[model samples]
Target: MSDFNSSVNLTMTINGVPRVIACNPADMLCDVLRSAGYTEVKKGCDTGNCGVCTVWLDGVPVPSCSVFAGRAEGREITTVRGVEKEATEFAQFLVAQGADQCGYCTPGFTMMVLALKRELKSPTETEIRHYLSGNLCRCSGYEGHLRAIIKYLEASHE
Candidate 1:
């Protein structure tokens, strides 16, 4: 009989849908997601240290770079591109507030913002900063980001 330890195809839920993709055991979630067309889940450091690779796995935000495709089997992965309602609000807010210059880090920031909005329907300025502490922005100071977040919360209330 075979050892049966070899890697096999893994299936997982991405953005509230099911996806069964063939991948090696060594393949990371980021790679699988990208290949499956969820390119929004970026690969920043690939070390799990940077929050850039963050994704909500069953409602808990985690680093996709550190996760294996098999590990994500049967789990719900929410990428920025998959969920656009909240994300669009964030993007619109960023543009209106002049926060997304260069736009390299907006995806990551948007993910964190989604998490914050889930937890706090309306977050204060300090709360926004505290929640977004994990995501790193290479350009544009936090002033615009803060403005965007605050404005989004305000709009949600109205």
Candidate 2:
């Protein structure tokens, strides 16, 4: 029998860097990443209702809080920091539209946006809203975020 509470080492490619991190089998990926100093992975609704702890798991956006750390072994994970250039560019639009409020959900939101940009060549407004439905922002009331995302997508295509 194996002890699930025992800590184990997992080698996961994080932000394009391979890192061996120690975590319990039961530990959530978000918690482990935060402990490993990836504070960008915020601790939100642990039930995966909130996308505040979103990260790229094998190039797909997933709620880290719902993922087991052990499952990430040998997998590629990309945080908002991994795509800093794109994140920064989007952030400018966010700021310009006054959508970068509180900044707690920015990282996860940015990750989703980056993925959306890569996945959708020319997403419609409905597609954009549908893609970002998982992420919630109380400060901006979503209007600002929608405006910023639309503007960012437009500027990026220009």
Candidate 3:
């Protein structure tokens, strides 16, 4: 259609399923997911710094808020709600390590951790810390977060 940007059929594999959505071309992936009833995708800065809108775009962690819906026409968006297993496991680790305080940042941390785990499966504290520099935590002072992720990395491999 000539007015493709206004109303287009976009297709993407979200989490583990393929979905075709009708939306505006300029809509950010974060809004699309949230509008599609995936509130777990989150909406933070919407600029990419907060990392609160993090999601796996084509298997790589990305801030959905900064991504255009048109760009994800054929990509995959893995939100926390869809990746419950990994999120839950990470949540368990967060609890075990006493990482969670307010809990607003837990999902972002979980998504990032899962991505890191998939890549390294086991990373040192330094590596984990360096990798997570983008995500901001208001509670726990990152000490507990670091401990949990490291522990999760260690246990996920065991």
lDDT of each: 0.79, 0.91, 0.82
Residue 43's lDDT within candidate 1 is: 75
Lowest lDDT 10-mer window, candidate 1? 1-10
Q: How do the candidates rank by TM-score, highest first?
A: 2, 3, 1
Stretches off by above 4 angstroms in model 1 are 1-6
The runs of at least 3 residues in candidate 2 whose Cα sits more than 4 Å from the true structure, single-residue gaps closed, are: none
| Per-prediction TM-score to the true structure, in the order listed | 0.88, 0.96, 0.91
Those runs of model 3 whose alpha carbons end farther than 4 Å from true positions after fitting are 1-5
Best by TM-score: 2
- What TM-score does structure 1 among the candidates reach? 0.88
User: Candidate 3 on 60-156: residue-level lDDT in tens?
Assistant: 9988888888989888778887778778888888888777688887777778888888887557778888888989876768888888877777777
At residue 103, give the lDDT of candidate 1: 73
Cα lDDT tens digits, model 2, 35-63, are: 99999889778899889999999999999
Give the clash count for model 3. 0
Candidate 1 residue pairs in backbone clash:
none
